[model samples]
Target: MSTKQIEKSTTEIQIPKDVKVNLKGSMLQVQGPLGKVYKNFKKIPVLIQINDNKILLRKTGERKKHQAILNTAKSLIQTLCTGVVDGFTIKMKIVYSHFPVTVKVEAKKVLIKNFQGERAPRISMIKGDTKVVVKGDDVIITGPVLTDVSQTAANIQLKSKVKNKDHRVFLDGIYRYSKSKGIEE
Candidate 1:
């Protein structure tokens, strides 16, 4: 290919001081104080390099496709590294005026019972290695992966959704109160 037809870009991601990153071929493994995470870039059209505490992503040719892959890889690598170090937390509270709601965590699933006085229990899925803790009326979802934690929280909130009910009148369901990095001590 001619140089004029090729596109090129370079992205650098700095590794955290307390985190250790290992790259073997197209797979990346990051270990930190909180947990370990793995990411694969095997099919992506980009070059990866690791030196000391930095990671470099290089893209050449194919315009936007290659550039997008490069940016995605860079972002995923950074997110995994940061997640393994600081972790992610999503806090939610159960709100019901008519009937009390109860939440229980079982394996990779969560059961929400008595949601708005519904006889059939509502179910939500817990993704990856996420931990769900039900205390009083508060539901706390936590994990090393941001996607897993956030998705789990979303699932729980969505499952308790009311249909055909006025949102202002029926403020009953699990709702996210706060989202933050790092676990509560």
Candidate 2:
């Protein structure tokens, strides 16, 4: 088999003062005023280097798949930096096909009720600092960091996923419409 060699690009990004990063193997642990986060990239053929003021990720090898990995790594690093510095947020909407759904936040958990006409409410685990609020049909989830916020949103959506049913007919699920910083949903 033959492989193609491609030129890699180096992107320079500034790290916030509050954030601290440590690299061990393919795992990168980042901590900041918002929270602490860890990202593992075992399959991505890349090198991560942290400097006094910036972090660099370089792609190695000749496989075309490395291009996607490189981009993903870069994005993850960017998100980490931003999240540590300012933080990330995700907003979602709860839609119902027939029954009206209601969501609320209690302590560190999100309470979901009336989903699919169920009598029992479903609870979504939430972090301590993260805030979950409900207004009409919109459920707003916010966190000091990106991973926690995104994971909480994903859990809500996953819990509403219908099984053995046509999605076109049953579209009652939590849907993401937009994100902070102008990122597409």
Candidate 3:
């Protein structure tokens, strides 16, 4: 049996007019109306080219792992485009049995108090320029970078996890209810 050899592959990403992308060596900077985002692709064995309104990610390797990395880079670039342009938002809801839980946004971290009637407060570190806003019973998290915004939301959810208690019955914690940019539940 004869095997066909693939010469090369490329991924193209189209961006909006208001967004600006700059590539300096392995570091990429994206600026938009919402904010700015930066990513480093130092280890990825792929070539990145940016145009006026589009980007091209070229992959020349035929290895399976290389293909995976190229796909991942492509997806990451797409996310960066969307995040810089439209931004990302995640909404969480505070639910408790009786003690009542409160979420506070500090300078660089989020403090979750009275979680499951616990006296000690749980803290979640905010990444990048992610903003956490506590309004009534809703916690709104927004940012221009997908990684930062999603990581902050994950930190908050994981920090308030119910320990020792049965998860099905003791559902008293901060749970993500809604989100944008394909993040939900």
Instruction: Count the clashes in each prediction.
Output: 0, 0, 0
Error of 3 at 105 (Å): 0.8
Ordered list by TM-score, greatest first:
3, 1, 2
**Best-fitting candidate, measured by lDDT?**
1
- Give all candidates' CA lDDT scores: 0.87, 0.75, 0.85
Worst 10 residues of 2 by lDDT: 1-10
123-147 in candidate 3: lDDT tens per residue? Answer: 9999999888989999999888878
Tens digits of per-residue lDDT, candidate 1, 1-185, equal 56644434777899999999998988888999987887778888779899988998898556778788888888888889879888989999999898988999888889999987889888899998889999898998888999999999889989989888898889899999999998863
Ranking by lDDT: 1, 3, 2
Clashing pairs in 2: none
Q: Candidate 2: where is the Cα deviation over 4 Å?
A: 1-11, 95-100, 106-109, 125-130, 144-148, 161-173, 182-185
Model 1 lDDT, residue 22, Cα: 92
lDDT of 2 by residue, 16-133 (tens): 7878888898898888876777788786678888888788877775456776777788888888777766765678888887998888788877778888888988888886466777
Error of 2 at 179 (Å): 1.6
Displacement of residue 78 (Cα, Å) in model 3 is 1.3
Error of 2 at 35 (Å): 1.9
